[model samples]
Target: MKHLNSQSFLEDSLKRKVIFLTGKGGVGKTAVAWATALTLSRNKRKVRLISWSPFESFSEPTTLKSLGITWHQLEAAACFKEYALKTLKFEKFFDAVFENRVLKAFIEVAPGLSETVIAGKVWDLFDRGEQDTLVVDLPATGHALSFFKSPMGIEKMFATGFVHRQAGNICDMFVDPYTRVDIVTLPEEMPLVESGQFVEHLMGLGKFHLGFLWLNQCTPDLKVPDKIPSTLDKSIRECLEDHRFRLEREAKNLVEAKKMPLVVKKIPKFSSEAVKETIEQIAAHMEEK
Candidate 1:
């Protein structure tokens, strides 16, 4: 069931050219990100789905190969090299200067460099107008905070160079009207708490358009029957009991989510495994007008 302020659920999410999905680890952000991308593609929106986290099963290439969406994984080393090439303005110049093994290793270990590279990459692609939409599955809450902070650091350090300019451009994407930072969460304790904390943190930073708080894997509410049919098998009864317990838990969590300052949109739980079809089901929900 949808929660408070759920109107325009898909519209508010899709209005942004770049939507960043983030939440606590294991909160199913990647699933929602892929599903949202799939919906965009099916609707004839040119979309690119990017993931910064480690390899996830949802990003399996074969599943998305026929979906008409461009899938990209942004690694620190590669993105940094791409940034270097753009700055140096020549492949030969980049190969000669940044070819050193020491610098390459540093790229992997540099603090917040991954975050910077990611923002820079997206900025370049958006500026180039390569696609109509970019759906990014960002790292968990803490890492995402670093991403929001990285560009300002780059601007301060370089002060006056290609890096500084690019950093400003990256920063621009954060406060831009078409950029969104959406949170995905399960109907549980820690995920809900962290979602609140993440928003509190955002308040102290640059103006970022807060989109929907995607309540992932919610169980559909069912009316409590006055009596259970004793004719059912024992194991089936046990499964029904479990379902009731989950519904109770989800109802309480939904109440908690509404208290937050963000609009809560829900995605009903589907298969036990997050397979290709699960994504397709979610895509359909996201396509709802």
Candidate 2:
């Protein structure tokens, strides 16, 4: 696999069939995913961006529609129903099985059932080879661990059967050359700590390859005067001090992050609040080679 840097990320994204974007909650991972998908779509590659939840304020479906990218929600129950229908190959049998209260209760409490089915859906989607790229905005930190590990759990639980086979396939796909994960994180202590630990666990699994570590909402290094005027007002001074503090934290975290064996890139805090502009900027940044 190519050792991808920020410069190569955008181009390399096209090379992968699936890219998962995940990080701590509220770190703008979704925006990065959308931008990546949008970039591919603009390049005339068929791209689909998958979300697990309903559209939040930032993810405007109309914008995706206008950009020629498909947006989809890959919910667990829905995907499970789809997979069961295909696997069982009989709608009546599916209804009969699901209609039984005991079976339904068993399904509700079954370990890894939801995650495996979701992973199965992902595998099925890729198996079809219908899209040029599938960009999944995966769940935040802890849930993401379960997302990738579900197949392994299922494989261990089922010694032989279609589910066993499917679980093994998902595991293979996890390490496939065409699949990778990119993480977005803030430079703050809590987020960085969580991200570092997450990376450790992820690498320990050895099932997935990390692509990029994106520093989101970053304040770019700027040439500021050595000191604020002595006459500056208290609030202004506070603001300047806050900016300086952020820069210091960013630098410290960046140094620590760079020590990791992965490419780290920063997505700067935007002056403009326009969602379209933010995505476009990130897309442009990712496209840099």
TM-score of 1: 0.88
Worst 10 residues of 2 by lDDT: 51-60
As for candidate 1, its clashing pairs are none
lDDT for each residue of candidate 2 in 139-214, tens digit (9 for 90 to 100): 8888788888778777778888788888888888888888888889987778888888888888788757788888
**Which regions of candidate 2 fall more than 4 Å away from where they truly are?**
1-7, 53-60, 92-106, 231-237
- Every candidate's lDDT: 0.79, 0.79
User: What is the per-residue lDDT of model 1 for residues 1-289, given as tens digits with 9 covering 90 to 100?
Assistant: 3222345756665566898889998877877888889887787778999888632334577777866668988877778787777777767544756668898777767766777888888888888878888998888898888888888677776668776777888888887888877899999988999998898788577777787888998887666565667898999788788888898888898999987766788888886584677888888877774
Residue pairs in candidate 2 whose N, alpha carbon or C atoms collide under 3 angstroms: none
In model 2, the number of clashes is 0
